[model samples]
Target chain A: MKKSSCSLLILVLLWSNGVFGQDLLNLLEAEQKDENQYAPSAFMMTRIAFGHSTEVRPQNVLDVFVANRFWNTPEESTQSFVADRMSSRIALEYAISDRLTFGAGATTFDGLFDAHLKYRAALQRNGDGWPITLTLFQNMSYDSSPIADQSVSDDFSDRLSFTSQILVSKRFNKNFSLQLAPTLVNRSLGLSAADPTSIFALGAGVRYKLGPHVSFVSEYYQVFNPLESRTTFDPIAFGVNWELGDLMLQFMLTNSWFMVEDAFITRTPNNFNFRNPNLNFGFNATYVIHFKNKLKK
Target chain B: MNKVLLLLTTLVLTLSNDSSDKVICRQGSVSFFSYTSVENIKAQNNQVSSIIDFESSKIAVSMLMNAFVFEKALMREHFNESYIESDIYPKATFEGEILDFEPAMEGAQIRIVKGLFTMHGVAEELEIKTKIEKSGSTFTLTGSFETLVESYDINIPPLLAGNIAKTISVDFRFEYEPYEEK
Candidate 1:
């Protein structure tokens, strides 16, 4: 009887061990045995108007945009505040990889052709993280406008302009986001004797989501011209961003009509103050195409 | 009698060493559908992990919250940032037992599994009807279930509630291979 009880005891002990040992083989242990934590999709788009957001398209995706800014300014030829405007921009942006984006575009407003390189430097996982979704946007534009100002000799190299800006944004919640950009626009051609070529400006943008597909966006840029004698205009714009399947449409009311950053930052012609005429209207459309749906996070 | 005792010991050892009772699936698929008067949204995650121990009648499945891919990027973002709070709870898991299940060497079995499903740090009891298929060395399990978003503490603001279904439909499939000792 003693031997029988000992044998029974060993059987129970081993059977219980087998049952419980397999129970400990949880799914989490077997999956991703040596993988790192997954990366999160921080933002939805590559650009927020003139300001480049920290967001980037997936690798091998191309974005085509046609942004139009039509302003009814008093035509210098007729001196009439009429809708006598034809200005538009066509741009193409491609995400070479997850972290880098290259773009080339042309704007007829200021007669400029520009190319830009955008690099995402940091991502804001959560909270008031430093360098939250910061992106460096560098653009070089060649102004091709006719030398209308006959007072000065037109230097071919003077038409070149370079813009460098750092866009910093934070998504406070699903409904609200804010972006700030410190910009420097360098023009080889100065407007006046006192007008310095290097211009400094601060840009602020806000996005409030009305729904999953629509958002209210506003952007403002404050320009500080170093030369006291040179007058600079600050541009303010409000718009609605509507998203379709793979397309996005942004309709705007603004005081500036120039579509290129080099033309508008501090050199905008339309003033927003009550003393000015009226706000002009504009529209921006973006369509993104994925060449390969290999977005692995 | 000693021979009988030694035989009993061998039987116990063999039972303990038997691994055919367990199965593992590393690439299970899970999808959820939300239908509302305004729109219908769907997402799928194929990186789901599942493990089943037939001896214990235990089933467990785990999937990363962000693993679900949607047709719309913005909707996916809202799911992670607002609805799921994926950073706080990065994964969803369910562990349960199949009711009155017996191992059939070759055949399909319909079983009911009752377990606790947890998402966004909220846990709720769920009962799922599963269709399990056995073919050669593979076992394919498919099932569907329905649950309320509110049951898991997923809050949709009144403004958005009209556009998002309160009741969500979840579907899962797993092709499990017998667990092998590494």
Candidate 2:
């Protein structure tokens, strides 16, 4: 009887080991498979944009005339004098982390060079149960012309201006998104003496996606200058962006033909200020290409 | 003694029958790809997540929109900031199953899978023909499909009308393990 009881205990032990061992193995296998699944949180794209805008305020009329005189001959040429305009802008973006990215780009038109650096931080993500994003951006620019030195003080010539904008965006669906940004602009230029209280600006933008590769965007910004009474600096822009796989293109219409960095930082529309008019209207084109690096899990 | 021997034989037969009817896979992996074209631009996300369950034929997946890295970091930034609104809709997901998978075995075999894909908070029905294979305790599945942006209410701007493609292609691969009863 003692020997039989011992044998029965051993059998029970074996059965329990097999049953629990299989259960533990399955759980571990499931966890390992989950970890093995590659979920990339960062991506890259080539961005290019050609955009033009027109100023509608009365104060812009004189500025428009000066711009027209600079770009066109005084004669009434039937060629339809195109005023202030910009060509194409090209930029590259790199994801620094799951929630952060850094970017830089150059815009060239006529004889101007504008370069800028930008950083974007994702404050909240949609899947996190929030349908909104709050982003902060800072950008700066430099002019490569001696005339820029003569027209603006040395402090503003090759200086970095700061514009802090808070973007609140909501995705209504998979294809449509809209955002509103309220910004504060601080210039190193002599604007402190000329227009001390005009460092604040209000802006809003909207994006509508038509497909996997096509989207439309529109933005409007208004700047208030304390030095100039009854006349606010406002610029409105409209553009479309397309994605063809590895390549992308952007076309736009706006009062500011400056590079995106300049458009927001300097608030200079079409390279012309509120002092110059000519309904600055022009287009920009940009192209992007990507190289991928894959890491082992 | 004869009766006891007969009972032992019955118990052994039952255990063997249960073990032989089921197959098991131990280690598996899953991945996905997304291709999007807008206006004069084309972009793709090559790395995505995938999940598989052989016993239930259940699958699950998730992908980050910001993961669609571009050549230009600025463009990628704008894509997340201005275009896809990644912060507002950061991830896309899918949950579904393979139907009638009893015949799946240890070689490349084609099977029909039908399930629901939820993106941007909208759920849509999807049908895909997946290739399946079993090798040394591992099961693999691969498939591809296209989704229209409009069906999900994704709006493409008129200015970028020429750059983006109306349909986006998605590809996936998944490997699964055996189901163990607790």
lDDT of each structure?
0.75, 0.49
Write candidate 1's Cα lDDT for A1-297 as tens digits: 878878776776677656644453453465554444433433355555545666776567788988887655454455545555657889999889777889988988677898988888877654434426788889888877787677765677677788899988887766778889899999866467677788899899888878655778888888877444555578788888766646778888887777777777866766775323346678888898767533244
TM-score of 1: 0.70
Model 1 global lDDT (CA atoms, 0 to 1): 0.75
Query: What would the per-residue lDDT of candidate 2 be over residues B1-182, giving only the tens digit for each residue?
Result: 44554465566445533432233333222232333442334445655555454434555555666666544344556566545666567667666666878535667778788877776667899998988887766677777787887787665557655555676666565565554443
Model 1 chain A scores worst on lDDT over the 10 consecutive residues at A34-43
Model 2 backbone overlap count = 77
- The candidates score, on chain A by TM-score, as follows 0.79, 0.59
Tens digits of per-residue lDDT for model 1, B1-182? 66666677776667557767778899999998889878788888999888887776888888888888876544556577657878678889888888987756578989999988888898899999999888987889999999998888775756567777888999999999988756
The regions of model 1 sitting more than 4 angstroms off are A1-43, A74-86, A127-131, A150-156, A226-229, A274-278, A295-297, B1-27, B31-44, B53-56, B69-96, B103-110, B114-182
True-vs-predicted CA distance for residue B137, candidate 2, Å: 6.6
Q: Report the error of model 2 at residue A179, Å.
A: 2.2
